[model samples]
Target: MALPPADDLPPLRAVVEAHGLAPRKALGQNFLFDLNLTAKIARSAGPLDGFTVFEIGPGPGGLTRALLAQGAERVIAVERDPRCLPILSEISARYPGRLEVVEGDALETDLAARARGTPAKIVANLPYNVGTQLLINWLTANPDAPFWTSMTLMFQKEVGQRIVAAPGSNHYGRLGVLAGWLTRSEILFDVPPQAFTPPPKVTSSVVQLTPLAERLACDLDRLERVTHAAFGQRRKMLRQSLKPLGGEALLDRVGIDPTRRAETLSVAEFCALAQAL
Candidate 1:
């Protein structure tokens, strides 16, 4: 049986048509109109009774509606697309004071300040092109104390795998190292390509990342430098791939085997190397 409508408002399809809002390729837009899926994505962030949700790219407000209906205390949606503003405005009207639509680029918006030190959860079907960069920004933003309590995001399957990939795995790289260093991340579920409006070519997955109460102490810049050099030539031995960064000597000083490949090094090992640098 079909799930009941998430809210009393018009269906997402009608909302999309009425607003003449088509997904734009330049913005990496792919509309997810399934209320069931959107609700599931919102719930994956855990209980929303008192937490404010920071959502990016809420096109036509499908996920916005689900989050409000699911009882999120407040939703601060940052949307870059001017065309989506009015559509989201309608939903804001429906929900009264529960929604705040910020019309601006998410990259330029300071989410930490917008959240105003409240316990916040970031839940969004992130745009594909800028997803990884966005994740990197959030991870490196405040190492001492993350701006948000938790993040539940959607990415292409490959990107999601990289976020949760382990040492010695094919997907392990800079992303996994940074994410592992700061948060405990995992792939919650895979979303098939067919589920989207202008269905994407590849499958997508939802990943959840919870901040570690106590993170390892290491220079974030140094870690990025090491990972960039090591993975820049992943197939090469550490001694060869990282030659520019004091290479073999640096690894030897850290007591790491210079012959080990980037993918074979654990997150802790990487942190040690970064500290040695």
Candidate 2:
């Protein structure tokens, strides 16, 4: 695909330098100066036309600008760092009504409220420090009715793998089970460490998740409790690990082998166990 034309605003590097913005480790900030990459990440969320995108940790508005340029109907960005406000404001000015910058912790922001009945997509290079928790919050926000149409997020490669991991895989755990129970997820691509302003020690990956129209019938809290216990002592057999819940008797009722380990259980099995509990 042909790269979108850069907006008339100054390059991200210049914006960062002019504003005295340095990628802060404490904030998990790693600015992406590569507009092409940003545009690619925005596009991965599928068509943006007529969609309002909620972006978290839009440091310096690199991805924010890309979303606007790529035809997003609107971009609502939640940024915690006050230092990036001026630069983000500059992008908002360039895009006029298309960009809205919210100055607050994304974890606390009520994204569904901000989306306001519009079709929403979340596209972000999430802050590493809180990326997983943010995703979990979104997934468990409304089990019966997900707020967004899709989510295209960048996370540390290991974390990304866990989101899309399958049962029986080494990476499979609570994250994988929870995500699989809610969405159809896959890793779209890997991003090298060198892509960011301050390179992280590990590579990054972009993962896309589209909510299932109808998720399996299970109590979200119960499922969470079941997985937590099962995977908390992953090396042990289910009979031992799940002893607090019911042990071999529980597995017998569910028809799953008591000797099976947590990693071997499918999302359906976990849901069944939760339902039984």
Off by over 4 Å in 2: 1-4
Clash pairs, candidate 2, are none
All candidates' lDDT scores? 0.94, 0.93
Top-TM-score candidate index: 1
For model 2, how does the per-residue alpha-carbon lDDT over 164-264 read when each residue is reduced to its tens digit?
99998999999999999999999999999999989999999999999898778899889989999999999999999999999999899999999999999
Which is the leading candidate under lDDT? 1
RMSD of each: 0.8, 1.2
TM-scores of the candidates are 0.98, 0.98
Q: Which 10 consecutive residues of model 2 have the lowest summed lDDT?
A: 1-10
For model 1, the local distance difference test gives: 0.94
**Candidate 2: residue 188 lDDT (0-100):** 98
lDDT by residue (tens digit), candidate 1, 106-182: 98888989888889999999999999988998988998888888999999999999999999999999999999999
